[model samples]
Target: MTIELLAPAAAEAPTRFVERHGRRIAYRETGSGTPLILCLRFRGVLDSWDPAFLDALAAEFRVITFDYSGLGQSGGAASYRAEVMARDAIDLADALGIESFAVGGWSLGGMAAQVVTAMVPERVTHLVLIGTTPPGRVEHPSEAAFLEHALKPVNDLADEEILFFEPASASSRAAAAASNARIAARSADRSPPIAPETYLALLQDRHAEDLFPDAGGYRDFLANCGIPILVIAGDHEIVFPTPNWFALNRVWKSLHLMVLPQMGHGPQHQAPEFVADLIKSFVRTRQRADVAA
Candidate 1:
C-alpha cells in the first residue's frame, strides 16, 4: 500500500547529530505550545514515524521527534542499555533547552519513556506509556512466535510486518512489508546491520534483569513516579500484546487505558486519531492541573 505523504506542513525538518556518546540522534521541531517529545520503538528511525499521525499531533503541540541512537540515519554506539537511551532523551531535551515536556513513545520507545520519568521525575510532567511493560513487578511472557524474531536472524521482515498491525488485511500486510523494505534499503546505506546480540541486549534491558540492583527499584518507579500515564495498547498486538498492558494498568492506577479494537502494536500508526486526541487531552488536563495546584 502506497502511503499518501499527507499535505506538507510548514514545519522544520530535523538536523542530524552525533552525540557525545557517539550515538546518532536526529530531531525536528513542530508547532509551538507545551513540548511533546516523540521517542521511537527499538531499532526504529525518525523517518519511520508516520507523517499523517505527526501532522495531526502538530495541531496542538511543539512536537519533537528523534531517531534513537544506533538506528536509522543515526549511528550505533558501543552501548545499548535502556538507561543510556533514557539519557539520550534527557540529553536531547537539555540540548534543546526544554526544561519540561510531555513525553511518550511507541512500544520500546514507551519503555524508554519510563526510564526518563524515573531519571528525572520533575522534568517530565505528563507521561504517555503506550504498548509497554514496566520492569520487575509483573509481566506476561511473550509467546515463542513473538520471541522467535529476536532469537533468529530474519533479514526479510515480511512475517514480522503482519504481526505488527492488526485486522491484517492484505493492504495492511502489503503496506507494512513495503515499509520494512524501504527501511531496510535506507539502513543498508546509512547504518550497520542489527546484530542479534544488540536485539538481545534491548530485550534484557526491558525484562527481568534489575538494572538498578535494588530489588524494588523499578517497582518503586511505577509506585510513585507521579505523572499522567497514558497506556495505549492494540487489542491485536502480538509482540507486547494486550495482556502486558492490562497488567500495567493494574499496577499504575493513574494510567488511562485506550484499547484499539482492530489495532495491533503500533497504535499511533493504526489509530492515529485515537492517540493524537489522547495526547492533546492529556496536555489539557495537565495544564488544568497546573492551574489548579
Candidate 2:
C-alpha cells in the first residue's frame, strides 16, 4: 500500500470497536503485511500518533493503533495497571482473530508491550520499544514543572511542545510544531482528550519505582523471550533519558539500540522518516531470522 506523503488523518480510516473483557476497545488499522500492533503513550488516544509516521509504517506493514478501554472512544471502566492493559491488548487481538503479530510500543505503551511479550512469548514475533524505560526505579525523572504542565490542559502550542520536545533549541522546537500539526491534521471524529483524573490513575503504576525488582529474573525473561527486539531513544530525553536504554541493555544484550541526538522523549516525532525506515528494516530482519529458526 502506497500511502500519500502526507500523514494519514483519523478521518481517513474509520474507527472500529470490539467487545472484550466487558470493554469496547476502539482501533484503526492501515497498511498491509505482518500485523504490527502499536500501543499509545500516556494520555494518548488513537489519533495522537503522527499521521506521517503511521503512513510510513502503513505503507509497508499492517499497523494497528487503538485506545485503551475506558479512554478515548473505547467504552469501559478506567484502570491504571500495566497488567490489565496488556490483557486488554491480547483480548483485542483475539477478537480480531490475529493469533500472532509484532508489537511496537512508545513510552507507557512500551511498558505494556513488555508485559504482554513476557506473558505470551510464544505469540510475539518481534518487539519494538521506543522512548521507554525498563521496569523498576526510574533513573531519570522529568522536571517537576514539566510534569505539572503535562497533567494540566495544553493552553497553547508552546505548552504542548514542552511535553514532547526540548525548549533549549530552536530547531527542536520547530520539529515539535511540525509534529503537532501532523497530529491535528485530522480533525473529524477525534477521540476525546483523556480526563485529568484518568490520566492521574494511568501514572500510578508507572511511578511505582519498586515494581520490578533488581533480581536477574526480569533480565532473564528479556534474554530468553526468543524474539528480535529494538529499543530506540533520544539522547536528550527528559522523561526517560538515554541512560535508561543503557540500563535495559545491560540485561538484554540482543537488543538493537538507536539513540538520536538533539531529540527528547518523542524521537519518533523529531525524526519520523528515519525512525520509520528503521522500523521497516528491523521488522524485515526479524522476520528473516524467524524463518531461519
Candidate 3:
C-alpha cells in the first residue's frame, strides 16, 4: 500500500498547545485509543514526523507529536539536558489530562524518555526508543565528519539523505525520497523553525558526554523498570548505530528489539508500514497481557 492510502486526511490535524510551567508546549494529536507521546529528534519540528508512520500508528493508537519548549511553536526556554526535556514532556501530558500513556523518543528524545520512565514510572506504561543512544557514554558514536555535515541546516534532498539514510546504498536513498515526500504532504499548519539559539544549544548539548545525572546507573534502572520497552533502529544508522542500543544489555522479559535491513537512522520512515505493524503488534500484545492479568 502507498503512503497516501495509509495516511488519508487525518494526519493533517491542526496544531494545538498546552500551557505548562509558564511555557506553551505545542502538539498535535491523531487517531484514538492508547495515547502514545512521541518526542522529536534534535532540530526537528513537529512537522518533521513521517506522515505515513504517524498515520499508520494513528489507525490503532492516539499518537501525539509535540515541540519542546523554545523550539518550534512552543514557548519558554530551551536546554540540552534530556532530563529537562523529559520534564517538559511530562508537563505537557499533565496539561492534556493524560494520566497514563506510552512514550516514544527518537535520537535526543530517546535519552529523555529513559528518564521519563524512571522519573514517573507509573505515568508511562510503555516505552519506545528509536535510533537513539543511551545517556552518558556512547559506545559507538557516529563518524564525526559525517555528523558535522549532517547537522548543518538541511537545504535540499542531499541534506535529508545525510540526516536520515545511509550514504552508500541505492535502496536507502529511495526510502529517503519516499520519507521526504510524505513529510511534505501537509502544506499548511506547519510548526515554525527551531530558534537559532535553541538549535545551537541542542547541537552543543547533543555533543556533551553526559546529559543524564548518574548516566552510569540508567542501565540498572531500565533493566528493572518493570515497563515494557521496544527498541527499533536501522542496522546502518550513522547517527546512532543499532549496536549502541544492543550494547546497553537491556535484557528483560518485556523488551522488544528490531534491526531493519538496509535502513539507516530513520527506520520508522524507511519502513513505515513494517515498523507500524511491529509497533501495533507490540502494543496490542502488551494490552492483552494487561487484560489477562
Candidate 3 segments whose C-alpha is farther than 4 A from its true place: 1-11, 195-197, 205-207, 211-216, 250-253, 287-293
The residue ranges of model 2 lying beyond 4 angstroms of the native Cα positions read 1-11, 205-207, 211-218, 287-293
Residue-wise C-alpha lDDT for candidate 1, range 1-293, written one tens digit per residue: 88954323423344446464555566766667788887776556565565556767888887787766665555566244557677778888987788998888776677677778778878888888666666653455555565555356553555555446653566556556554554344332243445677777866655544322324365566554557777787777766656755655556645678787766666676556568897888778853122111
Residue 239 of model 3 has an lDDT of 79
TM-score per prediction, in order, is 0.76, 0.89, 0.89
lDDT of each: 0.64, 0.77, 0.78
Q: Which ten residues in a row have the lowest lDDT in candidate 1?
A: 183-192
- The TM-score obtained by model 2 is 0.89
Give the per-residue lDDT digits (tens) of candidate 3, residues 18-83.
Answer: 898788999888888899989888778898888888888998888888888888898898866787
lDDT of 2 by residue, 147-167 (tens): 767778543568766667777
Ranking by lDDT: 3, 2, 1
How far off is residue 117 in model 1, in Å? 0.5
What does the lDDT come to for candidate 1?
A: 0.64
